[model samples]
Target: MNAKEVKEILDSAKKNDVFLMEAVWTRFFPASVEIRKLLAQGEIGEVKMVGAEYGVPLFHVPRSDQKDLGGGALLGLGISCLQFISMVYNREKPESIQASGICLETGVDESVAVILQYSKNRMAMFTCSAGVHLHGEAFIAGTNGIMEVLSPMWCPTALVVNEKVTQYPVPEPSLPLNFTYSTGMRYEAEEVRQCLLKGNETSAFCLL
Candidate 1:
């Protein structure tokens, strides 16, 4: 029941001359994008571990805690946690992936904690919860130092690079409204627009 046929879509895009990509907006966030650059510069000195957690009290929310209703922690909040891992590693092949979690009344998963072991002893640990509120923060910890993303890591504008913290002003949405983390959604859209206009199917940020 995996609706996203990523490889199929990628191949189609190449053949049809049309652009296609997953809507993983987190990948376009300033904080997530910067983390990759900083890592390439060896800012973290070879990331050995990545820890991220995302959760909220949504156990009663039908889309999160009801199996027949497509309820599950992994689909609801786990993608963001896994995004942190993808930001640091090539997930095409993991050395090993271990998962354990709890099931809600509807037989759907309420919480999931995953451990991804990779080559060179690199590893990642992340958790998603539909029953409680986590700090909503994520980090990339390496041998030299650690990079901490701001809360609600999914749409963060700031990041704490080692001891020095850097921040970006929350984006103002086109349609004025109270503050929303999703304001950063524009970054993703704009990246896509520019990519298509340039006739480039992908870029570092847009490829994934």
Candidate 2:
């Protein structure tokens, strides 16, 4: 979906006075909370750049190469990196975006890379792929120090800031999960619940 579609949805939600939110669960993680706290406290100074990478071996999955299935690296997996960038930039519009990618024979992206340039020399870059497995790491660089999100940055459980490490383990789920750290989704659920209780129409951490 494009900006027009997103704007329409937001407008509709406001007109109807209903709660609306995007389920970008990573932003609800404790690691994410810590990242925000550190930034707010100026522990890392002024953020200059943010970088993230996410990829997995999904070529063997038939839907991964099928355009009709909405199959592509950018659509399926790249959201993690893109959302991370948006979080760091506080949803500010970038000055420009440049992207490049490789596509499968079926014409779906196999690997994608993007660069977002913003004012004051701020920038964000990321890579996502379905053709290969990446290190799945991310970093935020600032004037004073840098912070690194550990592997599987999308659902990160740990972060390193200037040689100091902080870890947030996933909670145990009652049911089995198909992915690692999925129990962290509880945080997202609670966020929605609390918002509804308070008659909120949107989340402070995630905009409509």
Candidate 3:
């Protein structure tokens, strides 16, 4: 759907009794859930900072050049980076946000970097580019050690704790099209289901 339509639907859901939300599939995955638990349990100690990056070259897509389609770094890669930060920080929206981007020929953002400051002096740096190649990984730095999410956006196939790299196998989900192997999306669905069953409007990681 178009941006207007999507916004309307979200509004409708708020007005209605349904829980409407953006489909941020990565936040719901098993690895992500585990990461949250690790943080809560102090396995990673006090989280001091986080760093994440996501980007894609939109050179081949015509819509990428159209601002009306929300074709920009903020809406595209920024969304992904912000979503990643929210998930890592247990769905807490940043207390403050500072951002800047480079505009393209179509007046859309070609690339952007955003700094999010949270409570307890915790900070997250997110970056995205529609004009460059990027290794989409997220890092969580704490006092004791660090946790690394490799491919945190889509497959989310592996996670490394500190210096010891432990890989979790991605479960094959029976889904459609290019989403069949997506462990991230399925995990999010599971979290939603759990929340609904518990009569909770939000997940433990939900900011709102």
Per-candidate TM equals 0.88, 0.93, 0.82
Identify the leading candidate in terms of TM-score. 2
Minimum summed lDDT over a 10-residue window in model 3 is located at 175-184
lDDT of 3 by residue, 62-132 (tens): 78768988787667766777777777676676899898888888888888988889999999998888888
Steric clashes per prediction? 0, 0, 3
lDDT of 1 by residue, 2-72 (tens): 54766677778889888776688888877776777898899889888899999887866546666766678
- Pairs that collide in candidate 3 are 28-187, 28-188, 90-205
lDDT agreement with native, every candidate? 0.80, 0.92, 0.76
lDDT of 2 by residue, 27-48 (tens): 9999999898888899999999
Compared with the true structure, the alpha-carbon lDDT of candidate 1 equals: 0.80
C-alpha root-mean-square deviation, candidate 2? 1.6
List the candidate 3 regions with Cα displacement exceeding 4 Å.
Answer: 1-11, 93-95, 152-154, 173-180, 192-208
Give the range where candidate 2 is weakest over 10 consecutive residues by summed lDDT: 1-10
Name the runs in model 1 displaced over 4 angstroms.
1-16, 174-179, 206-208
